[model samples]
Target: MTRTLLLFATILTSTQAQQGFGPLDPTPPAAPIPQILTHMAQQESAFANARDHYTFRQDVTFETLAPDTNQPDGAYHQLTDISFDDAGRRQEHVVFAPANTLQRVTLTEADLDDVAHRLPFILTTPELPDYTLTYLGRQRVDQLDTYVFDCTPREILKDHRSLQVEDHRYFQGRIWLSQQDHQIVLIHGQAVPQDTRPGHENLSPPFTTYYQQIDGKYWFPIYTRADGTLHFPAHADALSQTVHVRTTVRYTDYKRFHATVTLHYGTEVPTTPNPPQP
Candidate 1:
């Protein structure tokens, strides 16, 4: 009897380690899952619209590390100010951009686009139908009580053209939403639909984005980081290689652009104050 009990305890510990979480609470949420999903989607839609009216600076860094030393052997760095033009057209002004030195992996346009948009993912009401969201129960994120959910795309569309490497990309990950505000506070996942074609391989690493309450109401992504190893299989001309890469993106200096734009969320129009300029 003693031996059997000890073996069961060992198995339970191993299972927890692999799953990354203990058993979820059997108690259901206060509201139905469908209702919760709709509310969260609406809040996210409002946040996305409000973010566009804010001007901020983004600093991005990507590095390929040496296996032995775990230090950067090659790197890419860029700093840009994101704001709207007089015509309210979104614009990005590069403050500083250095030559890329990465040798193993080349950064594609899609990768940079992901850094700008997908890293700070948003699932709006219209986008809700394109994804499948499953509630994973309640979890505490620092001091805030949050509801956890797994989000994945319903389909990955592929272009049939031989030259096209990728057509559509989607965020495949988990999100933590603040229970009080129904706003996303954190996202952990990666861009999916990575092309594994022999000669044209495109892969993305998993990443995490942490949001901070900006202007006292909206949760805005402030920092994001990704670390992973990408493997490229051998093709007709080249041999296989594995590259260890790390990326970090920081969004700061947020100030609401005083425009005529109006963003509404659940009948509430929260006032936003302009941040002090440096």
Candidate 2:
């Protein structure tokens, strides 16, 4: 009998109330829901574009825990710098990567992709139509007031072609938007459409991502954490097994990239503006 362990992604709830904030207020927002959603979509779209101009470092850690003792049995760690070249082309440089030692589960390409992209979980104007966002209420997160909304995919395509391509996964969960800026401040959810086909079970755990304001303009993902168990069902000649997984990703050292160009003609001098000091 052969068993395979696959790890994926998701989000979890936060203990906001216990953190000294008031409970979620169920009263309707003063502004129209449609208006609020529109504003959020626009703001998020701008933020997404702005993020591409910034360089940052990402550190990821994944661990598999022993079932009985809840102690780490195996782990994986990597540190990567995401930046741009002189030509302004994006580049990824691995600064540190330790050998993976996890025996219970294996990280799939989808899993790595999720850690790089989906874990940050941005919902811009173009992605708005793919999801149904429901206004939950208003809530205060520390010093900031936020609008709470439940988010779910409108549909998960289950056709044979789409399934084979593995392209229908979507984020399903809740988000907190800053009331003043209409920008996403936090996200709690998981990727959807987990493949449970016999002989091929892929499960994801819930996660939570917190954001911090960057340049006092856009909110950016700063930390993400997921801790849960995946139950792989029994298949032909294989027995069911549960694997506990924990993952944390940190995005830091954000520095915006500014390109400078200078051109001079015959007997002409061009003055290039000084680049901003780091």
Candidate 3:
């Protein structure tokens, strides 16, 4: 009996050595690119659908000119408030400076959607004109694997064509999105005038938005900055008139209710209705 037991113990030791003393793990490798993209799109869609849309308050600060030199020692302030329904309809109000007087114009849903969709670098695609979106690999932001999308616009969007132009024609910028949450960590775009001269130039606006996830399915912009410059003509009469205008907006003091974070801009939305309400 003793001899048999010793033989069994030796056999067990040999088997353990051969098997590396552990059970084999058959887990597969990570999913491929297509799978990842599909997962992201699904998450985005779900988040979009489940989001609570509300009106946002906006404060705009424009660097003002000194009537003589147009230098920006002072700034003009404007305020706007906008809310959107689930159907994507928007109601916006605007307020003017100094007295915080309310403006008469109210924005419709179509107008709101137009502004949101047309906002540069907000929605990036391969089709925007002169604009290119390149995947610049990935990095970790806020403990999430983020894919970076870089962009550049084709030209300054001054004409009405810019309104109708596809996303392919818009300004170029960089967008960093979290893979796991599909949250936008940052989005920035800059547009520059191509036809303008070197010294006397019109610089396109730079837009930057920083987003944070509130609900599991939704992300909101916590901060937004829009900056641009206008160049006056160098000839006589225009030389003395130099105006550098800058409009900046900050989305802060967020109050999260359900899936929506009620936002307040620097200013109030103008409240003008079509055809002038008597």
Candidate 4:
């Protein structure tokens, strides 16, 4: 009996060694290039044109890397409720701005528009003609394996396809698309050079956005963070200060206009919407 027990223990140890005593993971397969790009373009357009189909709250926080500031020094938050305005045109309201750090920055309306929408990096159908992409490899984003690619715009021309920042400003970036669903899971990089543009020279900053699978169908940009240095104009007789800046945007309180059911305990249960309406 003792000899048999010893042999069993040795076999178990050898089996564990063979398994490497780590997470058992299968290698991700290569993505089908054309299929992913085509399907991704369609989904992006679907999400883009779904402006009125969904409404959620956005909270943005920023901190200037001043000598004494470490946490959030300022914040610009708002609830984007979709509804027909008095003029019968659909509009979203900036229902909240807890702290006026965004005002302190004094960004122009166009600049705010770019930040609120474009910074999140949505590659819609109209924007596809503007970029050229190269498959890099496969990368694991959290538990999801993603196909990596290096994307660059063909050019920044007026009336031509580009990111459409400012009038003719164009941005270049890399994108990580999910292998299973062909959704853009991550985006990294910033606007091309802007030094010659004069007033808008330092507006662009490097950032990364992580997309979360929402409603089991769409990959929504649930969180985005940008950290970089900026030189904004100073008050009279004062020189512009070069300060480190970090901006984080979070999306929550999702409300979808549909009913859904999920299987639970061998029975179907209604999945509640994201949260209670404010």
Question: Largest TM-score belongs to which candidate?
Answer: 2
Off by over 4 Å in 4: 1-32, 68-79, 82-90, 99-104, 156-165, 168-171, 191-202, 232-240, 258-278
TM-score for each candidate, following the candidate numbering: 0.80, 0.82, 0.53, 0.67
TM-score of 2: 0.82
RMSD (CA, angstroms), candidate 3: 17.1
- Name the better of 1 and 4 by lDDT: 1
lDDT of each residue in 153-221, candidate 4, tens digit only: 677433243333455444467888878878787888775534433345446567788788777878887
Task: Give me the runs in candidate 1 sitting further than 4 Å from their true place.
Answer: 1-26, 85-89, 157-165, 259-278
Q: How many pairs of residues collide in model 4?
A: 0
Give candidate 1's whole-model lDDT: 0.84
How far residue 262's Cα lies from its native spot in candidate 4, in Å, is 34
Question: Model 3 segments beyond 4 Å from truth?
Answer: 1-52, 64-72, 95-121, 124-132, 141-144, 152-171, 191-203, 227-237, 240-245, 252-278
RMSD of 4: 12.5
- Weakest 10 consecutive residues, lDDT, candidate 4? 19-28
Model 1, poorest ten-residue lDDT window?
Answer: 156-165
